[model samples]
Target: MNRQDIGFVQSSINYQFKNLQLLEQAFTRKSYSEEHPEVQNNEVLEFYGDEILDFFVTKMMYKRFSRILNNELVSEKNEGELTKLKSILVSKESLARCMYNIGFSKFLYLGKSDEKNEVYKSKSVNEDLFEAIIGAVAADCDWNYENLEKVCRTMLDMETTNGYLALLVKEKSHRLGFG
Candidate 1:
């Protein structure tokens, strides 16, 4: 991407990249790179991002639900509850929805064939691009907690996660006779 593309995306996201190439690579799909041959695709970045996201989501769940582990009350949290919440937080559907919510759909770079198409509108493609963006950010920022946390808090749909977790807590409380 040109400097203008990087500038536009960074300005929109409120985060600047130390390396614009990494950010550009994040949006590059195999089809695009296959044609260019010199440009790198986002597959490796997506893989790394997936693992990093799992760590962040898992950490968030552990911290958010720490009371369940230490509480003596019947309304305490459980492994199952935390697991369920984390699963939803890291799921492809949720990530894609969050990406679209943030208006990153227009930035995806596909090959000439799919360039005109809105195929990036697909949920799975959005999810992959989301991961690629995470990977790109991680590459630029080095996976620091502050950087990753900022990305996670900004990109993940925590409000939806909270809603589901709230429901879980309510059900548990009801079963415990507190509701």
Candidate 2:
């Protein structure tokens, strides 16, 4: 991606990394990294971002659902449950929607060959890019837990539900034929 594209992405996230190289790495797919052995892929950042994302989500859940008993929060304990929830919240579909809404798609750096690939246009790509961006932000800035939480909350649409209680209520009603 050009410097202008990078600037656009940075503006969208409202956080710029101290090391532009880190930001570049975050956008660099394994395919491109293979061609440039000196550069790194976003996989490691993806790993770190994955953990940070889970922590942020779990903390939000606990904070928002403070009235619920510990045992009642079934989805908090199970690995599968957390994974499922993350998939919904952090999925490519959700991330791409968020990015597109914020105008980040225009800054993406897909290889020339994959630029037109249908998969590149899929939500998975967007989600992956978002995770990579998170990794980049964490690497670039002094993103403490509080700021990270704020970012995740904004990106995941967590502000509207306060731990999804309203969603749960609606879901339960629908299950019982109330819908």
Candidate 3:
């Protein structure tokens, strides 16, 4: 990618990569790597990122809904509810929406076949890209919690996600006559 394209991606995600190569790899799909044997695909990064993303979102949910009282942590949400919310936050649809919001599809490095098939339009591909980027950032920053958190929050639109969760909670409370 050109410097200008890199800059656009970095600015869009609100984080700059110290290792630009990682960023490039994050956008590289398996098909592209198949064509260029020397180039690495994003599958491994995506796997690592999927785990990290899960942990990060879970942590955020815990902090938001949990409280310390009598030296014990109590969560306002039940396990099932929290799980449901986390699933929603990390859903393919949600991640795809994030990619769309940041206009990231055009930056993906796909093989000719993928490009011809318009894989960029696939929600699954978009979700994979989102996770791959997170993986790239985590690797670039050496897994620094603050840096990863910042990038995830900005890239995934945590503010909006939190707002949506709040609405859900409020609606549930109101329905239960507890609000």
TM-scores for all predictions = 0.80, 0.71, 0.91
In model 3, the Cα lDDT at residue 164 comes to 56
Q: Candidate 2: where is the Cα deviation over 4 Å?
A: 2-4, 67-87, 116-118, 157-169, 172-177
lDDT of 3 by residue, 1-179 (tens): 88999999998778999899999999999999999999999999999889888988899898899999999989998999798888888989888888877778898999999999999999999999999999999999999999888888887783348545676888689989996
Q: For candidate 2, lDDT tens digit of each residue in 107-127?
A: 555555556564456666666
Which residue pairs show backbone clashes in model 3?
none
Give the TM-score ranking, best first. Answer: 3, 1, 2
Native-referenced Cα lDDT, model 1: 0.77
The top-ranked prediction according to lDDT is 3
Cα lDDT tens digits, model 1, 1-179, are: 66777787776555688988998898888888989999999999999888888998877766666644355424245778767777777777788877777667677779987776767888888889888888888889987778877776666652346555677788889999996
Better of 1 and 2 by TM-score: 1
TM-score, model 3 to reference: 0.91
Instruction: Kindly report which residue pairs in candidate 1 clash with one another.
Output: 68-77
List per-prediction Cα lDDT, in the order shown.
Answer: 0.77, 0.64, 0.88
Say which candidate scores most in TM-score: 3
Q: Arrange candidates by lDDT, highest first: which order?
A: 3, 1, 2
Runs off by more than 4 Å, candidate 1: 1-5, 11-14, 67-75, 157-179
